[model samples]
Target: MKDVNFIFIREKIASSYLYFISFLGLITITISLLEIKIPSHSTILILLLIFMGIAEYFPVRFWRGTSSLTFPIIYAMSWQFGIHITIIAIVLVTLIIHLHRRSPIQRMLFNSTQHALSLILAEWFSNKCMHLLINNIDMSVLYENLISLLLFCVFFCFFNNRFYDLLMILLPQPYSIYQWYKKTVTVFLCETFGFSYAALMHVLISKYSVEVNEITVLFFFFPLVAISVISSFSVRIRMEKERLYELFLITTEISRGLTGGNLKHIKQALKGFFGIQAYGIWTKDDGNWNLLLKDGKVHFDISDHSEKFEGISKNLVFNDWKTGTAPGDEIFDSVIRSLVYFPLIVNDELVGMFVAGKSRTAGFFPEDVQSLATFSNQLANVVKTRILISEQEKRMILEERNRIAREIHDGIAQTLAGVIYQLESAQKKYRDKPIDMQQIVEKSIKDLRGSLGEVRYSIYALKPYPTQQLGLKQAIASKIKSLKQEYELDITYHERGHARALSFSKERAIFDTLQESLQNIVKHAQADKTDVLLSYQSEHVLLRVKDNGVGFSLFESMVKTKNEPHYGILHMNEQAEQLGATLQIDSSVGKGTEITLLIPDSQTRGA
Candidate 1:
């Protein structure tokens, strides 16, 4: 069971005791007004009521399973037949009135009927036990002993289901069932001993009054008290065991969820573990607090007191009580009695606040405070890790941009500059010596054509290819058309499987890699035809570029080259790794090269 929930139950029991005491006072007043002669034995009824109230309200160290004291007390009072009848009637009336207030008349009547029947059975059993013990037997005093047993049965009938429900809600299946069994046995044993003690007391006070046998009283008292104490202790041990087990289970769930990087699951585990009314983590965003995760429904509008957080600096640690003028007063005016706030710090900056609220219990204790702090620390670590990963991604993007810029400047820009210089020199020579006009014109046209080719290449590199402009299917078709036109190579491109809009980074990488592979096939492979196939599977996006031409051993080339400057293969591999993909190359002498690039889907990326 959550510690907070257990505390709430404890508080409810205490409040119930006060209510019971008030009921007893009302009974006393009613009897006095009726001019009824209160029997000395009737005092047992008031004493029983008080004891039951105390047991319910106070946190007793002993396990006294609500039955131990309740049965004996009720049994002792049952001897006063008139008082028992009056109290029973009052109980029935109270139940009827309570139910009627909350439910429809028909439902209230039905519920009242059930409660009335239970009470009737209890009264009937009490009367029968009394009659049985008072029969003309050698042990007439046994009548008193029978009272405890009868009361135990009556109380068990009334509360067994309730106890079972409580355990089921608070504990896991196996432990809850075990606790229910233990409680049942404890109740039976306690009632037996209590009844025996009552019988012995009757024998001593009435039958052996003249003899005054101290030894007999001692013998009975020792065993009776021992039985009650032992039963109570056992019940307590079981409750504690169940409590600890629940705590361990909650902790395990929280740890597992956090390790798996599920912030939502972690938040839910924390809320369940602590039994808080509502909990949330608020992150700072551009001088405003934004709710990141929350558990439970909150009715109050937090925006009403936005000014409070507005002045609070980012990265500042602020507990619920600390930021307010009064220790416990805050902007929110809901059922939350206490609020714990932890500032999530990453790299010495306050990133967010882990806020948890209390509802049916007192503020967090020292242990709870420590736990909250630990949870916040773990939460901060997760946030920090995410931030670092994001930073690394940004850095990689910057580096890629710089490299692309350099490649454009070296390959295309420098070539265009050389062509421009040659054309300008030829134009000057044609103007100076009009005698060689044909040679100068041819030279100028050649240089101009070279510049135009460089410009076209640069533009083609900038334009979105068919694959990127449309999709991989169209891109492959476009590539095949270009190959047929440029090299007079009959290329057949085929596509199979479903297609999807891949991430921009992955799409760019795959397109560039395909471009390089096709270029290599045209420039190096001596083949008549080329075939490219693109396939999409459930796990990955696959692209295969092949050429029926002279192929070289991939493994041999890698081993032979130290600084081969084979940017095509190297760049392709780098892009694949960045997209969390895999690239495989297959080739052999006198055979075509089959280059395959597999970009995994999001689900397969993890694997």
Candidate 2:
């Protein structure tokens, strides 16, 4: 940047040959004016000025650089009106060119002066070549002008391009000087061709103005000009389409990366596509936006007044954040200096945003704005989808934890309680019979081992396993088999109606709930018969677990909230709610206990 500013000052200054050949040309003009009087070709000079002005209006821009019919027109003027008059004409053209291009005064002076210097050199060489060729002092008119024009073109192209190349060498460019030289090859060729053709046109117009039939050159020249302009624009348009096609592919790849729930991919994509240094994605959840930024990229020093960034404005892009009227101007300007903010739109509503800082001083282009408008919308949807997935995972974790809690409460805890009761009885009766105490101790050891096995199984309940891959009916039957084997109870399991397809998460909740129910029967029922029924209805799946046991009062257990309430029931209810289902518990002191789980259809569940 220091070198860049130095180069800027060097190019702008007007005193030396270091930055500008134009300065040398100006000095030459002043020297020439002091030594000689003004030449007598005022009419031709005026016409050249008019032509240069007209040519400036529709200068054809090409693949490498911009050019016009003015190049040849000026070359013709330089050869005919002589160096003094031609330099004036060339300067007038430079004024119009600078005005049309909106260049600074320094650029205006440099370009105008450089072109004039090249014209003078080219004209002098052409005259010298003509004098040398005319050995006999009489040559064919066509051959004489053609030879002179050819010689003039060589000098013209060399001086014109090299002068600018020299000025470029004196300045500091981001690229190497050799790279600039390689790039200007096409520019040199185009200007050479243009200068030669204009010279021919000057000869043709001068020789055949009155002879209407001899004006055939105009036909070929006009078509050539038309083709040059048309071809230049066609190539430019085609290249732009190809660039956009590549951009589409790039953006598509970025969209795929965004869908996978990685914030880094999103940041990298947006940064590379927009050619920015940093980006921040802000998404709203329950009316609060969570800001995402790269690690160690931005210092989070802003205050909690982030609500100031609501309601972005729709306006033309402003290069500086402070000058722009985009929503959340402070976020981009005060909190963090960003070049622009691209809004994330979903369903025609502004949902979130991502900001980009320009890699260069020129800032974001309008075409870039249009492209990213569509891109931002897609990004917002990806963020929304990721949030949903993450939340589902969290709910699944919570449901699994609850299921484990219920398994511990119903199985291991109850088994230990019964063992404790037996041990108490043995302690109380130990003084009467030592043999009875030893047998009681053996019974308690057996009870404790069974409880340990159940505890191991409870721990396994917490381990991740695919519940949906195994059918719900088969899974329930497996649980009942384990219960029957462990307790030596006559437990029967049955199913009715076709099982509906459920997501893996939903099946997990249903399976865990059923397991908890069977464990409750084994621990608390103290019954001879236990039955489990799974019935899949048209709109909902119904599961029932019944036990003919010493049933406890549901109201009494539920009312005691200080740790005596049935945690198994509470867990089952939570699992049911998550599945958009209901749990029903029916029990009394003398009657059997029955528990039912009702899971609804997808549509009903969604509601």
Candidate 3:
């Protein structure tokens, strides 16, 4: 509130200062006009030009350029002396030459020359027009001179230092139009009241037909002082309000843009929001801060603080710190102001820190600090959600690997071991007899081929061909063939309804589940015949693997105590779940085990 009042006061004072300069210029012009002796037209023109040149100086430096000379020259000649054409041409040519000059001294010298030349043109034109417009009236010379001086004074006040400074200070700040209007109103009121009071005092002093008294002069001072105070307060209030609003906008924009998925977006958002000198986000890896994002193209030196952040698991907590304040400790103090290191926490663990520095402005205020904390909290949530999803995906992958490993060990590995045992037995029998050499070779070749077949089957199981290459029906048929050949079971395959290619995931899951069910039938079901059927219904693709074997009760076996293993049914259900399918199993004492898998027909039809 005090800051706002201060800015208001400043603006009020600035506006009054401009009015005072105008009043002084008016007084100078009035005195010149009321002179006892009539000055030569040339002298009057020269004096006006000098005042115009001085007026041009303020705007020139205020604009930080030499181009403002045009405003005063054009106003003085066209309005006061009525010398538009010749004076304008000379001023244009001189301004062009002046701009082309490299040195400031040369530019100023050219400017002075142009002012003098313009004065001469104005005097010549005025002198010629005076004779034609007014024959016996020397009043023409007096009027022209007085008007020229008045115009010069007015132009001088318009380009005065106080006026230009007030404008420059307000223009680039936010809410410029409102601030300008407020200042203008304050100045208008002050000038109006001052003039009115001065007029009233003049009237009161002359009531008795006497000269203006000291009391009347003192009365005039009150309005000038009041104008200065009011203008200052108005200017200060407007500026403070504008600054606070700008800060609020910056915070809101930064918050909305700094979502955690894109590191570049976060950095860009922060840079625009804070207008800081330098800032970055660093990910904490193995106790070290790794730079992930930075504003602009600054190369930050992390060598010194590498060890400090290396083992710091949580956010590097700093007390009484701010966004850009250099670190309080000796090592980090040189390059930074206050450092705000906020941890990017996810799932109750810290992932990274939003480390920022402030150099261009003072450290963040309380509002900015609170805003930063809120932004960090939001960032942490995003980072945490992403991390959790990633971990879940990784766990799923590991589980899949384990399932594959179990399948290889139980099916292909066991089959190869049996082949090896058979070959060894055949080898011992052949070593004892020479007459049955051909039979031994045939038996050994058979055993080796069986091992090779099992190896091939394992490879195929690990990486099946695309469903498009061979339809899902053909792929399932192939797997059944391999199982029949390898296991030598009385396996029967059947298909019903229209068969079509299924989605990759659906096909893989159905094939894997079928394999597990058949393996269970071969290893556990003691029945002589096994039947596998594939069929499509209105909304689902169904696969049933049934075997007339020594079936155990699924419920009783699944509920067995700690020492028992029941991975086959669990694996089959998991595969179905993965493909968004359903699995059902039925088994009873003295009855065959029947397993059915139902996959959505839409999925199989490439929905």
Candidate 4:
């Protein structure tokens, strides 16, 4: 509750700040326009405005924001017709662009206000510098006022960036140092370009006529627009590559079945890549659609009729709220100007739905739709794969239960039944023959003990292996002690190098390999002693089990196990391979067998 209250207070403060800035900005513009005087060269002014609009339209986009060639024209205009004219012109251009883009009213206000304030400060700083440079310098002397013009560009860039930073602080978007540096460099470059072009325009206007300078301005701006268009194309190509890379990462995560744990990461990546404000994933459970994942602001009910989903299953459905072309306005909030539904289908079957929404009508372009379709297809396949894996796991569990049930019936159940029969016989014979009853009772007691042992063994087998609870070394030591007590088989355990924690899978595989090796020796190796060595290296961990017993041919054993019920070696090898490890068996007739399990570093980290 306190956190919520704190957040509410912060938002209120930010809102107040924004309103204050906007009010100041409006007041400044009103006052400035009251003193405004139209210049004599209306045709040149119109040409400059046109060029400014073009520059604003084709901004060089970066991750954080955009850069544009408007600075040169704005600076030049301020030098020619004063700061008020420059401010009004830029503000008008900004308002038009924002309105065309359907930007939020608050954002547009904030941006316009910030830009106006920065210009006012820049103009003030430049005037002070001009006075400091020369007692009474005429603005018409382009060569004499060069230093002042350069200083104006510098101060304007600084003030503009500072205001933008303040805006970011108030709104609070994610920050990146690399993005900040890139934006700073790009902005500086644009300012330099603007300074150079404005100087050239000043030179032309002073030497030639304002009319001649207008033509030069026109030609100069055309090339700039062309360059901006090229840059925009390059940015789009980069975005495409980034999108493909992001999809590859998501695909790898899904393939590893890590989606359950990495859903947050996936959501963030998708949101950043597509620039969507909200998204949701729904999966079909039985006959009902269930929401699996949802992120960002969601204002409307997602649980619409099944028929609506079925209708859109054939293709993606896009809705534009601004034009009233949306068929399902109730499904999304009024704030969402554009909403899209991508049916998650597999083999012509509607398995689920992926819904994404943005606050702009042209949010989903043709290329964006293509990418989203690919993403939806990938998600559908993953959902299907998850379902299939779940079913397979359940089936395996059921089979294991049946196997345990049979074991109980064949071993403990029969033994208990025999003990009951013997006890019943003894109870009946006790009255007639007391001496004979003692022997019968003793025999029944022994049978009961055997049944108890079988029950205990079954319980032990059902529980998790010791390696899972205890560390690998401790578990192996316990097993060796037990083997020594039970079979009187001489065993020695050795360790080398520093031990580090390994992943559960790697540990389990190593432990299982040890068990299989010992079991093979106990059953068939008619030998006296065995040795287990665990060596940990920088890049890999090695576990070797050597038995001084009657070893068999490795090739012959593998071939025989292929047909026979014995698959201990094959199973161990398969386990090692699955973990990107290696299992090697070195054995020959009459020579002792050696089993080595080498697990690389990749399998050992992330416990």
**What are the Cα lDDT values of the candidates?**
0.56, 0.64, 0.54, 0.76
Candidate 1, 247-323: lDDT as tens digits: 56555554443343566556655555544556666655445666556665343454334334433333222222222
Q: Could you tell me the lDDT of residue 392 within candidate 3? A: 90
Candidate 2 has what TM-score?
A: 0.50
By TM-score, who's the top model here?
4
Q: Give the candidate number with the greatest lDDT.
A: 4
- Write one digit per residue (lDDT tens) for candidate 3, span 1-607: 4743665575566446545544543343344335424223544345445433333332211012222323333443344345433243334444555455433432334343434343443455555555564675555443544444444433333333244445346321233556445654544443344334334433443455544333433343334434444554554456446545655554454445434565555554555454344555555544555555666423546435433443444434342332233332222322233455566766667666666555312245444565566666776665555556667989998987898688768866776677677667776876767668567557757766766766776676667464556767777777778877888888888888766656677777777777788878777787789888888676888989998888898776666633322246776677788777889888887888888999886634454
List of clashing residue pairs for candidate 4: none
Model 3 regions more than 4 Å off: 1-261, 285-288, 300-307, 310-338, 345-349, 386-403, 430-607
TM-score, candidate 1, is 0.46
Q: Candidate 1, which ten residues in sequence have the lowest lDDT sum?
A: 56-65
TM-score of each: 0.46, 0.50, 0.36, 0.58
Model 2 agreement with the true structure over 214-262: per-residue lDDT tens digits: 1342343454456566666675577568557746765676557454365
Candidates sorted by TM-score, descending order? Answer: 4, 2, 1, 3
lDDT of 3 at 389: 66
Candidate 4 or 3, higher lDDT: 4
